[model samples]
Target: RKDALFEPPVSTFQPTMRLANVSGINIIPGEDTFCMDCRILPCYTLDEVLSAVEQCCAQIEEEYGVEVCYEIPQKSESPATPKDSPVVKKLSSAIYRAHGIQARTIGIGGGTVGAELRREGIDCAVWSTLDECAHMPDEYCIIENIVKDAETLVEFFSE
Candidate 1:
């Protein structure tokens, strides 16, 4: 079960395979090949999680007598944004004003431009309204949310 806090954090592994030529509908592919997109929780280091994945893949290779190859094309980890930081305080105030609710801070494993900014010693509040379909198939934006988010941004910028 998932809670709003994302307590203990969460990791995801999504594999995608593309088959070019399949002669028969019932026939399995001669070789399995896929890329894994792993969004590791911020609590774990890349080396630690990568080593674990390698060990698991080794076991899979031994069990199936097949080879497996995987590569990390890109990866980044960001330090947590301090809840009491000035930027956070400002954003929280803006959010509360625009939405008429308390603003809370939380961490997520998703990659964002904020990672780069944070690494450069800049603080930013990365947020969104509902949908939660980022980086997934059939992802779309809700117009209502866009308008509401604009209000939030206006509140932020006007501060």
Candidate 2:
């Protein structure tokens, strides 16, 4: 017997948070494999994103012998912003040129913790001095980048 009243249709609804999950396969035994996730923030433009992605891909290939892939969530649009923003344009450009890498900006179409904060009227920005080495089995941070990160934090707090 079919129970029409209790038969709810499978949801076609999509989620509202966007993310970039990265992973690497190890060709060697006993070496710690790699994986990480970046909770994306809203981006200002496509070109900015492209630049950042190019930088990331180049960096990963050089440093880890791997290529990172980007997966975009549904219904996202490329944002537009000034090409001269110090963080977006200048820093990314410098990183790419000096290291033969690429840096581009991208948007997260769905909501995130960061996005939720913004919705509650909190302002925020994100950056990293080194490749985000947050959660791999043998994860590590670069000393130089730590110093630079400290300096940047000081500068931010000063303002």
Candidate 3:
């Protein structure tokens, strides 16, 4: 059962809220509601996830005789940046100049603001040299990394 939890090929889902049955020590019964934070994968569309969730709720309602309802507060897609794009080439060159190594573009499971522009056919990248400590209590960045990243940006822009 634990393996089945992680075996799905789709995006990851984490239960973030439970509106009812907070404590299971007793039969503190009420309307049960739960929400999942879905991190979409690049391979699947938002419509696919929406359809799957709707189907799941329908099946639960049929099998359990309990009313169920759900809604997606927000949804988005982040397309991968093309490798040969001018932006990618410039950023890669700057990174090489700053670090003496080649930089490669890669897709991420997380969403980025660049996706908004990307939807409008604008070529934008969410590239950064961050250590990815976002939202953590002890999130931090090294000064050297910042300096190098600045240098890379300067090089990218100056060219």
| TM-scores, each model vs. reference | 0.74, 0.31, 0.78
The per-model lDDT (C-alpha) reads 0.77, 0.48, 0.73
**CA error at residue 43 for candidate 3, angstroms:** 3.9
Candidate 3 lDDT over residue span 113-137, tens digit each:
7777777877765556678698689
Clashes of each: 0, 15, 0
> Which model is ahead, 2 or 3, in terms of lDDT?
3
Q: Which of the predicted structures, 1 or 3, would earn the higher lDDT when compared with the native?
A: 1
By lDDT rank, best first, the candidates go 1, 3, 2
Candidate 1, residue 5: lDDT: 43
Off by over 4 Å in 3: 1-10, 19-24
45 in model 3: Cα distance from truth in Å? 2.7
Worst 10 residues of 1 by lDDT: 1-10
Candidate 1 lDDT (Cα, 0 to 1): 0.77
Candidate 1: tens digits of C-alpha lDDT, residues 1-159: 233444435667777655465678898777755576676665567888889988998999999998888767787876667668888888888899999979878766667788888878887778678687877899999899998889889999999
